[model samples]
Target: MSIPALDAQGVRGPAPAAAPRATTPRRSRPAHAPGRVKVWQRWVSPLAALAVWQIASTTGLLPQSLLASPSTIAVTAAGLISDGTLPAAIAVSLQRVAAGFLLGGITGILLALAAGLSRAGENAVDPLMQMLRALPFFGLIPLFILWFGIGETPKVALVALAVSFPLYLNTFAGIRGVDGKLAELARTLKLGRAALVRHIVLPGALPQTLVGLRQSLGVAWLALIVAEQVNADAGLGFMINDAREFLRTDVIVVGLLVYSALGLLTDALVRLMERRALTWRRGFLGE
Candidate 1:
């Protein structure tokens, strides 16, 4: 037994057990998780792919008529830049997509809010949306063209139509999937609907809503491609078609690459938003 320890005032008590040092909890790193790779490492595969393509082109291993190699495509792309056709097409296409995306995205979010917030809203809105959602978004090109004519209106409308469904579905599901207990707690706190949505509902739905945004963007690009291909267009699609008539495979390849790069760029943007928006979560992303 330990003897009591007395202070200057002469207190009697069992010797205070050696005070255990306060320790901070150590965070465990995920297993088999290598540290973040360098940014250049992410480009390794694509660079290697380009190298292979270049080799094949230089060796004449691939038919230039059928498949223009990376170097040829690069040369064509450079020429297009010099000529300004490519740049103008890019501008026109970007304008159409931006307009369509804004219109469709807003419509989707609003409808989702209406449906998610009330049973009556769901009954009134969901059926019509579902019916339209059933129709192939691209297939409506004919109708859109007939109604809006073979113009920018049909192209933009097609993109908007294609984009809206995914956003609506994902936003609706995300809002509805929020924890019921949280809703009850909000009610107990006498939170106004506006405050309730701002503080809890919207935050809960953000992850999935972002997912929908990504999907909608992808669909928007797809719709743009199809819509542009449908008529006498002033976009990349038109350029690609014109190149086909000239048997300019390199130009076609360049157009395809530009489209791909646009998709990748936009996807990267959304991913950046996701990382920023979901910073509070701790998981695979290590946010």
Candidate 2:
């Protein structure tokens, strides 16, 4: 047997070899991780519902007068599209919505800025706004008709009124909710009033403002539907009203679907804006 090596102090044996590390098996990621879900999965429920509806209609369980079959509605929609009627109505509705949105958006932002920036403005503006918000806006249709008449003005004004409150409330809350420490830091850095507002306040309030925008858009469409009932000669509301006179349930359904589609499109646009604008924000939903 070989003798163990020793030093001047007479230590006996070589250091024991280091133990080998145990390897752990890696875990496979969950299929349901954020953004990992397939796009088709989202449509499954809606498609299934639609299929059930079609089957029910085909089996005569669902009456056409109550709600037309999906196939009938689809055919009617195609006919409307082939002619210029649907396109013209859509254009008119789009114009009205655009005008109302612009008018209301500007008014809301200005009011929010005024109230948020000054105690005097808040005292002067907020009470009136609060009182107005308390009242059902639809109740003002008669007053609006008296003031602006049964023309497009009243319709647009009603939509504007509906759109304004949400934005104003949200923007005001967002401005007030901004971190005071950030404002203090801004002051510490000697930021001017304009610079502070432009750089800090507006950017800080944007997320809430976008949320308000989505709410306002939904309200706007609802308002448009009600407003158009008051003597609209052109637009989806007019088409629906005309269809009601002739008992054309499919046309009415198509009009309602168009309204829903518009609302969804607008909401989707606001969501996209939120994603782009709030890239820096990380909430419970991981990117």
Report the number of the highest-TM-score candidate. 2
The global C-alpha lDDT for each of the candidates, from Candidate 1 onward, is: 0.84, 0.84
Please provide, for model 2 over 95-150, each residue's C-alpha lDDT reduced to its tens digit, 9 standing for 90 to 100: 88888888998899789989987899899889989999998999999999999987
Enumerate clash totals for all models, in the order shown. 0, 0
Candidate 2 residue pairs in backbone clash: none
Candidate 2 Cα errors over 4 Å, as ranges: 1-52, 55-61, 282-287
Residue-level error in angstroms, candidate 2, position 72: 0.8
Residue-level lDDT of model 1, residues 1-287, one tens digit each, is 01112231122121121122223223222211222343467689999998998888789997787888887888889999999999999999999999999999999999999999899999988999999899877778778878999878998888888888999999999999999999999999999999999988999999899999999999999999888888856889999988888889998888888899999889888978887888787365343
Considering summed lDDT, which 10 consecutive residues are worst modelled in model 1? 1-10
Give the TM-score comparing model 1 with the true structure, all chains together. Answer: 0.80
**What residue pairs are clashing in model 1?**
none
